[model samples]
Target: MSAITAAEGNPQIEFWFEFASTYSYLAVMRIEAAAQAAGVDVVWKPFLLGPVFLSLGWNDSPFNIYPPKGRYMWRDLARLAARYGLPFRMPSQFPRNGLLAARVALVGVAEGWVAAFSRAAMLASFAEDRDIADDAVIGELLAALGLPAPEVLARAQAAENKQALRAQTERAAEIGLFGAPSFRVGEELFWGNDRLEDALAWARAGP
Candidate 1:
């Protein structure tokens, strides 16, 4: 009965996303419908990009650290967002603290609220240009999703959820995932929102 249960018996596509990544936002918005049409199920895996970057010796978001790439990313997100018929607005903070959001997403995955929470959080951060680090925003997102705000917030702050989220990020790095919106079918890594369709195709073909 869960959204992900639709993928049962079909290949499970692991979607690794970062909260602050613009391209990831685009992927979060459209991946479900595309995967459903293709007879695949999307496993929403929200991880922190900060740890991934730190593992590679970077201190900040590639967008802020690399001016040209950062500039191009914004424009690219605008175009993609428009194409997807989704609202587009850059968050006030370039790289919002995704720790809280990612933790909550981990809980959502277990509770069958992954897809909705992911979409809402992405919209709140990217389209509404809100600060995701604030507990208030995340609390609001949980409420909007009809999930128990206190329970979800407690899970996000709990030690177990924190560790689980960190492990997911570590696993992403082990699999050579350096960006948001990356997809994996088995061990193969497909990066970017543009690569999603191809990933689904690969899923259909069975690894």
Candidate 2:
């Protein structure tokens, strides 16, 4: 099916994603094409889910806490990745520390490198099976995106960027977004990659 098209007037869609989230990778890789066909503009909002979990008293990933879910999630990710023609390999780390990556994303968003940096970081983690928690990997990703590695790294770790990342996370919580890959069209909130199409449709239909 094709993406949604607004009948009269509609608000743009805001896609919130986390680098450490597997399903978000699938959504990020596919959402652009869908948006283009729908004649909709997407606002990419990169945020950290750690704070969201913490607010719910979760110190670890739900998948790790629930073995059955973890197993199913990995398998599901592999299948989806394969279906999308993207590489499929689970990283050694279950939940890589995404703080640095979130900071970098915040910097990128501010500097208009949001999409590029987000794609590179996601590819490194999901496709290449790279340890995204490591600064070196992130630096490599920034370089590959044609960004000044040192400068980006410095900005990512800087107080301002870190605060911005934290603020984004808090804002997500305030907006009732408890998960990754959430799409918001005006006040409407749709969670999960699977709901992307529905979110677009809702966008086309207006608030």
Candidate 3:
């Protein structure tokens, strides 16, 4: 079952995203308005794509391994970001380490601030070019959200919370997710930032 399976019977969409995914950064920025317009509730599910890629025999991001694709992705992202009026900049690092962010996101999710926290983290990476893997960055985001940084960071790094995040990633795999910025409306899945609107429509229509 999906990590958000419990949301069934509602006009809800499961937004499965990776912090390091360029396209996920796009989707996370505007999902709220889109979902609201479509009258769909969105459940943010943050999971690691590194494990998913490993399952497909990839040792690293396909974009990095393939120069042409990497170039195309950056170009496409710039064009799309411009179209959406969202600020975006190519980070100095490609496919950054998002483990700490993912763990902390689960804490944000439980605390009812995942949406804000997720957007801030993405902005920090794609818009501001900050190192999200740095604890200082994550701490700054938490503080902005009016959360106690030290306490939340401790909880986010707890053994149980780490295991919980791993379990969510495992569930994403079991549900047949092959990429980030994916959406699940009941059993139907949509991939890519471009499909976000379609996913919201599906959610509004129900299964």
Cα lDDT, all candidates: 0.88, 0.84, 0.92
* 135-160: candidate 2 lDDT, tens digit per residue: 89998888887889898899889887
Q: Which stretches of candidate 1 lie over 4 Å from their true place?
A: 1-8
Worst 10 residues of 3 by lDDT: 1-10
lDDT of candidate 1 over 161-190, digit per residue (tens)? 889998998898888988888999988889
Off by over 4 Å in 2: 1-10
Which candidate has the highest lDDT of all?
3
Question: The CA-based lDDT of model 1 is what?
Answer: 0.88
Candidate 2 overall Cα lDDT vs. reference? 0.84
List, residue by residue over 109-178, the lDDT tens digit for candidate 3: 8998999999999999999999999999999999998999999999999999999999999999999999
User: Model 2 — which ten-residue stretch has the worst lDDT?
Assistant: 1-10
Model 3, residue 53: distance off in Å is 0.1
What TM-score does candidate 2 reach? 0.90
